[model samples]
Target: MPQLEPFYFVHLLVWGFINLLIIIYLNTKYILPRILYIYLSRILISKL
Candidate 1:
């Protein structure tokens, strides 16, 4: 198929890597911390 072209493969790989990096960065920078904070707060409240 036309999608099997080498240039298209490289383009797809580059964009995929960039998108993965952004997702990981955002998860660590924002999502993970918020989740951890909520979990810890629940534990603390339950212990009280």
Candidate 2:
């Protein structure tokens, strides 16, 4: 098999890191709050 280029590995690593950061940011910013709201609402409804 042929060897891969060094730049390809670097590019892939950079993109992977960027994608991971975006996912974490989105989860905390949007998904987490939505989930928390749903959970809190359920609790509130149960108490009523």
Candidate 3:
């Protein structure tokens, strides 16, 4: 069984959401693009 604390609940939840958004943003804008580029380049080089 766990005890629930009340104060700062909204703050914690909001921070979690913000962190999730940052991770999603970074993966979509940065990581995914780089991965796609690298994979495409490798395939192109192999073809050439």
Candidate 4:
């Protein structure tokens, strides 16, 4: 009943979307760079 209400549903969707964007941004900004750096270092070390 409450979940089916339009206002609540819209708010839930908006918050969920915002949270998703934040998570993606954090991963790309911080987590992905570190991972890529480590991966590339390993490859370069192997080549050398």
Candidate 5:
């Protein structure tokens, strides 16, 4: 079998951390509020 390279693992770790940070930032900045608004609006409309 051919020997696999090692640096690929380091690159994957760095990108994974960066992607996780972006997901957390997006959830805090945008997705949470948008989801809340949609949920609240549906409940409000149903109550009428």
Candidate 6:
């Protein structure tokens, strides 16, 4: 059996933060623009 150590928790926390940042960056780079474009297009269509 393996014992849990403090460093394990620290590593997990660091990796979790890194993964979160990557997800946010990818979303902002790709998904966010498409979402904004769709939203703005809908608004423009409604106006016209």
Tell me each candidate's TM-score: 0.88, 0.84, 0.73, 0.90, 0.65, 0.85
Runs with alpha carbons beyond 4 Å of true place in candidate 2: 1-4
- Model 2: per-residue lDDT, tens digit, 1-48? 236687788999999999999999999999999999999999999999
**Which 10 residues in a row give candidate 5 its minimum summed lDDT?**
1-10
Could you give candidate 5's per-residue lDDT for residues 1-48 as a string of tens digits? 234556777789999999999999999899999999999999999999
Candidates' C-alpha lDDT: 0.97, 0.95, 0.90, 0.97, 0.91, 0.95
Per-model RMSD to reference: 2.7, 2.5, 4.0, 2.4, 3.2, 2.2
Residue 19 C-alpha lDDT in model 5? 100
Candidates 3 and 4: which is better by lDDT? 4
Which structure is stronger by lDDT: 5 or 6?
6
For 1-48, candidate 6 gives per-residue lDDT tens digits of 246687799899999999999999999999999999999999999999
lDDT of 3 by residue, 1-48 (tens): 234554468779989999999999999999999999999999999999
Clashes of 1: 0
lDDT of 4 by residue, 1-48 (tens): 766699887999999999999999999999999999999999999999
The superposed Cα distance between candidate 5 and the true structure at residue 19, in angstroms, equals 1.0
After superposition, which runs of candidate 1 have C-alpha atoms over 4 Å from their true positions? 1-4
Clashes of 6: 0
In Å, residue 39's CA in model 5 sits off its true spot by 0.6
On a 0 to 1 TM-score scale, where does candidate 6 land against the true structure? 0.85
Q: What local lDDT score does residue 27 receive in model 2, on the 0 to 100 scale?
A: 100
